[model samples]
Target chain A: MSVAQISRNEAQAPVEQREALPLRIVRRLANSRELTLFVLVVALALAMTIVYPHNFPTGPNMRAVLLNLAPVGILVCGMMLLMIAGTFDLSVGSTLALSGVWAGVVSGWWGWPAEAALLIGVVVGAVAGLINGLIVTRIGINALIATLGTLTIYRSLTYVTAGTGVTPISDSFAEYGRAADPVLRIQSPFWAMLVLVLIGGWLIARTRFFRQFYFVGGNPRAAQLSGIRVDRLILIGFVIMGALAGIAGVLGAARLNSAVVNAGVGIELKVITATVLGGASLKGGEGTVLGGILGVLFIALIENAMIINAVGVFWQGLVVGLVLLFAVSLDRFKTAGRA
Target chain B: MGSMLKSTLIALGMTALASAVTAPARAQESSFGPADAKETYYWISNKANLPLFVQYDYVGMKKIAEELGVKATGGRQVAVVGGWDPSLTESVKKCIEQGVPTVVDDGDLPASGRLAYIGTNWTQVGVAQAKKMMEKVPNGGKLAMMSIINAGNMREAVAGFKAYIEANGGGKYNIVSNEDDGGDAQKAAQVTAAILAANPDIAGIAGFDSESGAGIVTALREAGKNPGDIKVTAMEQTPDFFKTAKEGWVDGIVVQNRELFIYYAVKILHDYNHNGLKSAGLAAADGGRPVPDTLDTGVLLVTKDNVDKVTAALGVK
Candidate 1:
């Protein structure tokens, strides 16, 4: 080898080796959406804890915040899945109301068993989802149009089925939602959300069957040519989303012991916001369940802090929207830096 | 023979035409004659999905429709149930201009040229709520009021509540926060918890919407507080309110005369349609007759003692 080439190699080797380990770790964290969200969530919690030690970090406040964010967190798992597969459901809020109303009717009015009520609620949600899936997969309608149409239709059905909603929906059924852990004293809804997030994260990150969704979302034509059942996977994704909404609905109704006809109103936007903030893109195939849940946690903390500080309700939405834009913009910088 | 048949047919047609023209005139001659099927008395309202409307307004409309023998149509808009929106005021003005008798419900727009408003006097309702709170906590203490505060009627209610407390509370009652719950039960519960956490010395809570009682009760229960730990007075007589009050989770409720509002509003509009301006002894101005400008539907205060009586009278059981 020539001395000139040798000298060039020696210089390049030194430059590469001189890059510090800490700088590399920082770059890796920046590149990872989930890690960045985790850090932000921890940082926010620590800040609130230090600033409002008496109110923000108290047991009752923590429990309330967790319980309140449970429904949105549960919905995020399904939304993350759909977003990863390049499709989404706008009818989740309506589906939740419909499911909850049915549960109320069965247990409160019809004298059905609590278990049957729960099962029926979930089944109704699944059926609603099946219709959405069939419309999109079989009829070839866009996911947005199909879900938006069903959103109104399902809400109307809920109103038709029970106009004023059912109150005092049986004490036995309410226990399912009211049950809490002894240590944390957090409600069942929060626990349900935690379990779902863990299982969803594992399945999407490690399982080969679920990984096919990433391929389908990335390139549908290529995925189809590769013998993947793109339509079937998308359909399954919707069913799962529907069932999660059902679970959330029943749990919420049980917690309040009332099946409100307007339950879950305008929740679709919040779920989508968290999902996008968690790293899921409209283009799809890029987010994990962990990132999505962390996004929910961060938003929930911000809201809790605002409430603790006695901020006006009008300002909460603006703050959340700005945070979402800022988080998404960070990705652009990270990508540019990588290039 | 054909000409004779044609002449007979023409005579019959002329008789039918004359009868048709005279029928309405004869009907108009009576003070309150039977209503024709085509004369529809529309009750225009907003937020038709509210449980109050579902339970009372629609049911009352059905009864009035059957009695009056006229098609009772309720034109409902899903948006803007409260506050004074220019659009709603304009709509009422246009109705008056078009010679449509419009009576507002739930919230009133006085400048809209509406014939009448058959709903609670929001300020008075607030005063009533304050009285109930005072009764429960006679000495008074720190309090929190929750409602959709941006709404015009709600603002009036809050103002009335504060005024009553200030005037009659002997300076004992203190309201620390007036939180907006967005008229949602779940959001109400969340805000209630936050309020409780922030102000531990809170002695009472006043809810000024239908969804408030359930939310307040749920929040209290979740916080592990017992019945009567914090006095609560809410508006509306919903089934959930009945259940919570019966269980001693709620102290008192100020229920508006909602059914009466619907029942009387429909009857008044029906009477106007049949009787016209002359029968009511009123002059028509701007193509609209002056009827009752504001009808105070009034309210009923329901404690645990009187809840059963009120709910029973309303046929809630």
Candidate 2:
């Protein structure tokens, strides 16, 4: 791995390439999709508040929205990084099943400690991601194609191992997953997700190895000429995604107190939708962890609002699809001149 | 000598032709008998991804296989074409390749060459659910339904529901909305919530899939309505569904008799394989006899009266 040669510069860029004064303004204007999304999200929240007057902005509803965002929230973190690195991992939803069911086996059946089981689940997720990376990089498969195949394979494997039902585990396991402190006014996993987003977002924005990821995604030939190990960086992105998805699966199992079969089903679609809605480019080379998550929150808010307001759940895809199309179109418009 | 040999050959050819003409009668008898080779039976479902329901049917079939000292293992087909229709064909091909006497669930394999089909008559299930809904909401009112809308299983159930409602309620009852939840819990919750929000006057909601029950209950809870405030007739029972039923959060559920469906299939295939069922007077859909093409496993409505029996029976909660 060329990772040993890569070091974190922490606060400074390795190369001193500065944007010209007027160009900076144009650059910001061209990439104002996130800025527009941020405004839309704020406006949506306000509109929801106006409609409900009482329930929309309540603490309990906020908790629900955050909890709903937790699984996909973690996913958007990895996806943003991966997307920024110019690849994708669609197998996360299926890997979630595999990771959760396997942990249920180790912890509940094999009588391992919950912590150890959780660790093992995360490791398995990492391995699944590693395999995905290898297929895409080493075997010369496209990222989308590799992950799409694994998605079905992993989900089927979960069914083969855990069967097609919820495998209930110990009560203690559920505690870790669903525990809510009355004082905090939120669940344990909600706080954990907040911490993950904070750290993950910081790393992407600040770290040297991660900064190189943008170049790899933006242009592989340029990145290769610049001495960046594009494949390894992409592989790390997958591992991060897999690990986060694993955590989400284990948490889901714990919350249900059962190993759920289809817990993460269709989540990849949601994560991608939210990511794109949050302003990540499908062509790669751009996105932020916080921005992607805001998009997640926006979608989650809409879903919660739908249920809260009596909107048709079937319309979620239509709404998200339209929003995504709008966001991507705006992104294209912004990048047109630069490209 | 050549003329004598030619005559003999012609006589042998005549004898072969006579047998060929009468072969259908003999072929029928042996066809009813067991195969000379010892092997296993196959049961693959198109709706195999639905683990809660699929696993139970497979286990029941597996139990029968154990009793007969045969083996069986199956999986779901990836919904590639026409949603779920392809699964049936794919499973049939697997069975054909294995050369096993196969019984398929979902029963809509077109012409995939299966011994027989065994599963809930989803239309009948809808009928039963509709019947239950009418019983609950005797005073006709607005109703809602939550399902994948286009799924084959849900398609029949939805049809039956609409048929029963239209037939029974006349113009008295109205279906407010039949929203698709896409088989996701969160989506179900959101859909249920929205449906309830718009139609606060909604008298009954037919929770047509396993996901719909909890979604409906949770939305009701979130909306500050008692689970019993709305008349809910769920189509399937899972562990969570049991909790909702017990808490009076779910009014009743139409439990598909999957065990009966799977076990009956095992018995039919085993009986066919072990002996000449035809010789034992098994009518081939003829002679005004008892031979039938499909078995409706039927559904049980688990309400307050039978909630205990159902929950204890399932041992889920």
Candidate 3:
């Protein structure tokens, strides 16, 4: 009986082969873009280490790089999610400025508790995002146009709140900006970033609602046919992005001990660059939390190395732009190969 | 006419004598009546922030006008020709175009056609600041000059200081850097931090503008460096800046009286309206003013010793 069964299975092996090959190919292609980006990040890190053996490989230097990139990392996480959901939030930088200014004004100028002020800032950001979502979805405006409008409005709001200057935060709030303790010697923002990354990773990987996000971005018509709440998901994604930007704003304000009206000027470009470099397609539906963190770290390391090498400030922007172009090109090549 | 003519001649002589005496008396009594003076003058400024000329300095001149019972009216517009360079070239151009007879400038006005240039002698200001810095840092050390914006005046100030230092025989002092702070306090602070990190031995820093000074003070405090460690000097006085100075975060500041600029500018404008540039040579009592071309409105050195007094005088508690 066992021999007869084995011969029967051998006869059906070609049928199974016909079923499995295409699926395997598709799966490999799906992961190829992210895998290539990951390799590039590792290669860049290795190159940095080789160039600055004494500082790049050291624990202190690595910690500094991580700490500096924490805010950028948090922002990129949200930016990637938004991109995955097929929307752009150019107003994140302005939102960050507004949140920071409000937080500083509420707590510093008005002497409110830090916790309350932070809550209000986050809420304000969420509300702003909601308005952006409504403008994009309900009002049938393009995400880019809606966000650009909010960007100017929010920036102007920041100026008004900050009275066109820097508003200093309280000492206690500033303490939150410093490194946690000697044993860790890592800033509070670093810890917050790690937690945020973990939570974002879980949301993206484990939840069914989160899975719906990919479908919405991948094919909105198909997702709508499949009974996914596409509009709601997009709105929620924007809300999360806004909230994260708010958190970043507060962290930045705390670190600087002052909320400058121009606090997050040009930050949107950096965050978007990191997201795109992390393999989050501008076309939508592809990104990873780990990839975003690595992207930010790569940029931070380059900046740190440039500073350590005593490069002129004027050249910094050009160098960063070139690096961004290179990363985007590599991403495109990898994506093309996968397709 | 001899006998009867003798009588007639005596009468004619008497009549002629009477007519001559009356004519002389009438000439003595009939002088020309007093003429009415012109009451309006045209004044112009490069921009509202032309500082001593149009803003704070104008207040003092307005008071002088009121005291002298002169009617003055003019408009302050953004710099028409020059943005930062307050050269008389633009003012001269404006004067000629507007048919302005007399002109008073904050020294930025071109000397051409202007009745007077009544602002600080910038070169002298630079020399004075440099001299003060030298006095503060006798042994001489590295100094950084922070400009609000890298404008012409600041460049001139730096040039003046550099010339003075060079002329006096360059000693232990050198200008380590000249950073543009963009008049933003945060940026100013960041730039100062970078400068300090790059040149830790900077013994003195001078701010060419208000915000830069505040930024330098903040950076110094954060770096755990004392005011004495780096002799800091800046232009103008704000409440916060004075507080910092009181706490010894600043060595001294060069305070210019805006009143002087206003008073002189208006007076020069009046002189230009009535007497033109030539009449500006007349004494103040004689309704004549000095068209020094470059006026030293005056500067006060505010140090720890005089910080309180100056603050009190400025009413900045």
Candidate 4:
């Protein structure tokens, strides 16, 4: 079966025989990766709430957790799109730093209007993405190698552009990130990520043009034979990925009001981890924007729990890695159930 | 043919006389100038990208290089020894054996037989921070500290801070939280916000890492806490720190002599090369102006009262 069909089959349960409710629930969880991640995220959040009632469930703590995960959450939308198209960008972390620095230089150093800085920063990120797309499609370089090369190149450019960093990048520019709704009190980055996830989810699941990425990722050669313009689709996927990374980068810098050169260092791993857990296969064509976002939520909760528990930071990676492996291992049960 | 030979001989004679004439002046130039303009010296550190190293240490090295007429570059250079890893001590020893001049900074590695030790006395920095906190919160309440707790220097500083509080402050101070900010300002801010959430009664915060001060102040502003709501003593003397100090968020800053570390390390290296001290070997104990065992570049306490004066002197603003 094609990779696109693989994800679809999860929803169609076999009418073979009646089973115990517990077994049915287990089978249901195994079948849907989104359900599994959602359940897991809910469970983790509930458990933390129960255990550390005062600390974990408080308004300030929740706000901090939501705000902290915003960047990763925003990046996951683009990553899910790329992974659905059978490729990914490792340069996102560096892209974030580079974009933030440009924004800082424009608004903070050059004394441009905040809107101009925001526009320039996003444009820089899209241009960077455009370069990645051209290189991968035209040069036919592997996405891994192409993006990995750009990762260091972009980071080096960031340092060359602003050695230490641009701090206190105008209060007007900072307001874009710092502004929060009175109801939830969550910052702009979180709100931005939410809007992207909702829109991206609808477009990928419903729209004809976005659905073409599934065909391209599932089987590129077959997709091209069917007049899919596989390379064009993949290139578009990368550009979208880059633009999303740019938005994330700009928001992060604005929120902090400081464009740190090392902002989002090693964040690519976290983002990729969340994408994989969200149900994106390395071979592609098997994930949802919702799944990717749930993965981000799960990891954020895990980190928040660790922080609340006062666990050493060293244990965090171990916990997250083990959880990822455990989540992926659940796929084996789904395969067995299909048999 | 004989006339041509005479002309060559006369040219050779003039060149020889000129070299003889300039030799003493050349020797005198080499003697006075500490380093050769053609030779390049390097300022090496593990985290060269760190703001402390980038903004101050590297600048200091470059300034000294210009003065000494030598080119200086910040490179990976030999092995940089920091952290709590015991293996690093052996690595330093091995590098020392390979005739590499290693200098310890921020933290001491005396067993490694380094040429000289420069930078803040870590333990003293902690004591100074603690003392500053004591000054602000005389009847001390619960205190929280932020740093990279795993680092060797930070551990010493924390221990010293704790020891001083125990010995000096008659049971008034209690360390409620000592968390690691991981040296990233953003992470520091997040951690500080969480810390504030967890410890609503947190009386004061002592920030050991350079990033901690900004993080603490940012967290306070985000939480809508006014200046001096909770006493804060932080490290480093960055421009952000200066701004925060002016706003009265930070009670006192335990400022390390960052530039002085580079200044003294390069001086030690220069003298080691040009002052005929190369033969002094690993310990440099052969007695020809033996390398200073340790140069505690020391710390400066910058409070709101003297922040303007300090910033003016450092030309930070």
Candidate 5:
């Protein structure tokens, strides 16, 4: 481990020295898709603002968009990391449901403190992820199949936990969803998501242990020869993904003031779509925190625009489907260019 | 090996016993009311999770059954036939072919030998809801109507509402947009949210079903829009709908008595199965079995003023 760290540090020093203006620009483009998506998002926002000048550009409407993105944005960070690590976790949606139900059952039904319920949710999520990681890595099952199985099982568990009704949260717990201050008028979830994005970005870029995540994902055999514990890294990644999902779940429950058994259904698809759209390759080892956030923002902007434009609801699925196809096509073009 | 065989035999026996216990008792009663024989009524619905036609309706019918000293039970079963029209017609045909003596349906089914249709008058309900909305917004702005499916009873309901809006209200009422949510609340909510965003000036919205209604209400609340800002109406008397009404997010709901439908349907089936259609005196009109060609089980208009009355009637409080 010490030898691998020294070698990686030495590799980083040379790359830093070789960095020039053109190289920096290229690196910036490569590392963050936000520039492109930010422009697109701004254009869409402007269009909406023009169409519905009275309502669309207002502070409250902007706050609504940000608030709506909070949970998915947070979950996408973990999803991007997992995708970068060369694995997928479709169980996050189910994990979200289970975590929310667990929290609600504990706090609302069993009279547990909201804080304790949240803790339990995160721990349980991590445990579930650990099991998934072990099965995928040790038993050599495909991550997709393993996570898919867990998805069904976990969703069924949510049904069993909540029965059939929405489990209402206490008023005190619901207050967590209120705005932190008047300046933003955005809910706590949005602020928490920003903090998560920063931490995630730092972890991916600055941490020595975390740098090994890319190598392990890029090539497990090569990473193992470099003395990185690939299996353990994968396990840790899954656990982090699960914990983030749990936090998102708890936040969702708080925001809705109820833990609906169906709260997070199909969320995994959205998270993965955002991660992939952000330039994360399914083949592994390439994605950035900033890029993932931009991807989420872009998708969210589309949703906001659809709503603002009064596009019929049936067209939403069609629009999302088309966007996903475009993103995949662009990814192929980028990969071909690199090759 | 002998012990294993004995255990296997016992397990098989237990399995058979369990199935027997859970299976519907054969319909062999002297009359529609309970006799020495135990009769079971099997009712099938389009969706298992239906809170209204399946749950509330069954509960109401069960009460009537108990009053008449009969045993009643319902299960979450989908029609082998799909779609509102075919499903309704097929359900009736299946019931007749399978010798299901009496079948009560929520939608209009092909009348062969079935007992009755104890469901909402979809056309009337839609017309009534539309009339109320027209009264509120006399100039009739854009109205959005949501349905679970674009077929059968829902199609009829929307048609009825549109007819009334067009004829009586003139150019005042116009259905600007319609959406089918596949009867899923989350999908319905998403659809409603999108619709609300697109047409903020929409004067009224109506959800043709319970889940859609709840979804529309949730979407409205999420958007921070007041219920009165856009007149919203829904069908069924669910706790969520009741709360939405109380909170002033929903303007009104058309309530159907599902219980009465089920109770009478079961009774008619029992009578037919026991005495045959003719012997039961169901063949002719007035003097025969009291199977009205179209029994108006009746509907109640639920609003803020009368919500408490409806809730109390449904024992929701």
Candidate 6:
């Protein structure tokens, strides 16, 4: 099945028809949550183009939109997987801080190469994720409580580690994050996020390994009865969440050119909001990486539009909250109509 | 329990209790004010997680307090602080409850029954930044402001900035946008980047807080724009401000000296307690009028020409 229909497809597939490319693409689009988002995005983009012909449509502003969305896009991949598996990672923002700060310490203070610092950051993220997995899987703790504990621990660690003001990263490393494509004016992180999305989408579609995630989340007892290693899969899902947060942290610190202690504050809330708005349910087994990435794009567009229109900065939060509410309500209305 | 162990436990408990008391150490009643000058003084700011600058201000208060053989009190270590976290109203209530000689800083709560306020006038800080911006764009330019709009000081600053532009900017200095960064460097960079993209003609930025320069500089650097491309005036300084300012990303800095702030806050309270408001020169003796409730500790405008000398003199670098 295509990624867009991951846990939502109700009909059993016919071997012959499923093999047809045109049929599969059409079938997915007909039911895809992402299609609605794509339409909404394009519509909004066009509206913004008309309203802000001089400002919004320019290369620099468009680039800012993409750059702003890049970190969120990278996060959507792992978060989507975890959401589909009936789990949440509240500590992702704190994990991002912990990873980024540690990597910064090694690279900047300890005088290690930037590459080593980057690796350490990603590794720290993986370890942090693995710990959350162990607590939830082995200790039978609630994912919420387990991750909440890690959240406090990690954010406090960020303060302890990054507490001594801004820890400057290597100049070259920061410059690399800012490097852009000449023609498009889009930065490297945006391109990197696109690749992650493609890979994430492919993982959900082509592999039975990924397909089992739907089974595990959609019906854990059934998945276990079918001999799926449900615990191991959940563990891997959490690991992916952590590692991705790590990648985002490295990019975040590099982009800002310093390890900022307050950098990741409230980000997990934003990521979770974006994930749910993208059509994921907290109950589990109902989201797409594609939808989540688009959710990132949609939010960035709103922020840009609000600023260009000279709306009060305080209204940005209210608008975002309303969008989230609207998106959830639409999902609920759809489900109720189906019933 | 063994007798020796019991005694050791008691000793440790007593030590912990003593240190806890010392953290918010109440001073002995000595001769109060500058002349007789030995007493405990309390400086209460609104919040507990004191920013670095505020800490420096408190340190300066301590320096003077020591010079006069007195004690300076209240900081993050003080079990209770009046920042907006729990509401300054609650902190003020606590001050009244504990009978702490509280001197409110920056933010005023006469309703909280504060004895006095020692801090800069935020509106003037805003005016100073606007003046700097105006000096740069003598012919006018599209200007954006990065501020924390809801912050009490920021509200004053924004009001001052708007007032100045209206009165003197001659329609040249246009306040096209106001972006509240919520003190997030990353968000600041993103907003700055967006403002630049949208307003290609944007010529200057007035940054109203500590992190604004850091965020603006990062955004400008990534956009491949030089500091010369835009005139930037900001409040406070960050670690990288030294290089960023010298390189020209920051045009002028409005410095609110923390030392002078704490010194005056404590001294005013001390003088008031000793000789009364009139004797402390906080009240007009001739007219029986009140000294202005707010004190503008004042600001130093540091530009490229004097940033080094100023920062060096301030010992910030």
Highest lDDT: which candidate? 1
lDDT of 2 by residue, A1-339 (tens): 355444544223534346677766655754765666677778888998888766677655566667667888888999999998888899999888778877777777668888887887787688778777766765667988989988986776666555654455677776777677767556666777888899998998899878887898899889998899888888888888889888888887776566766768888988998887776778889888888888888777777666656555466557767777777676776767567
Q: List the residue pairs that clash in candidate 5.
A: A310-B198, B102-B269, B140-B172
TM-score of 1: 0.87
Worst-scoring 10-residue span by lDDT in model 4 chain B: B24-33
**Which digits, one per residue and each the tens of the lDDT, describe model 3 over residues A203-271?**
887888887878887988999998998888888888888899888888877766666566666678889
Q: After superposition, how far is residue A253 of candidate 1 from its true place, in Å?
A: 1.2
Compose the digit string of candidate 6's lDDT tens values, residues A1-339: 877696445444554335478645544543566886787789999998998788888777877788878877888888889988888898998888777777777777677877887888888788778878877776667999999988877765565554533446777667646677888878777887888899998998678899888888899898899999999999999999999988888888777767665567778888988888777788888888888988888888988888887888888889988988878776765665456
Return the interface RMSD of the candidates, in order shown, one decimal each.
16.6, 19.0, 31.2, 17.4, 10.1, 10.2
Better of 1 and 3 by lDDT: 1
Clashing pairs in 4: none
What TM-score does chain B of candidate 5 reach? 0.77
Better of 4 and 5 by lDDT: 4
Q: Give the DockQ-based CAPRI class for model 4.
A: incorrect
DockQ: the better of candidates 3 and 6 = 6
lDDT per residue (tens digit) for residues B60-136 in model 2: 65566566665444432111111235445765666545655555554345466555556677787688778878888
At residue A111, candidate 6 shows an lDDT of: 79
Better TM-score candidate (2, 6): 6
Clashes of each: 0, 3, 10, 0, 3, 5
Across B178-278, the per-residue lDDT of candidate 1 in tens digits comes to: 88876678878988888887777789999987887788888999988999999998876355567567768788787786766666676777655655565
lDDT score, candidate 6, position B178: 89
Give lDDT: candidate 5, residue B172.
Answer: 67
- TM-score for candidate 2: 0.75
lDDT of 3 at A27: 46
Instruction: Assess the local accuracy of residue B20 in candidate 5 as a C-alpha lDDT between 0 and 100.
Output: 35
> Which candidate has the top score in TM-score?
1
- Per-candidate TM-scores read 0.87, 0.75, 0.63, 0.86, 0.75, 0.81
Model 4 DockQ (Cα-based): 0.13
DockQ of each: 0.16, 0.11, 0.02, 0.13, 0.13, 0.23
TM-score of the second chain for every model: 0.80, 0.73, 0.71, 0.80, 0.77, 0.74
Error of 1 at A223 (Å): 1.8
TM match of model 6 to true structure: 0.81
Model 5 TM-score is 0.75
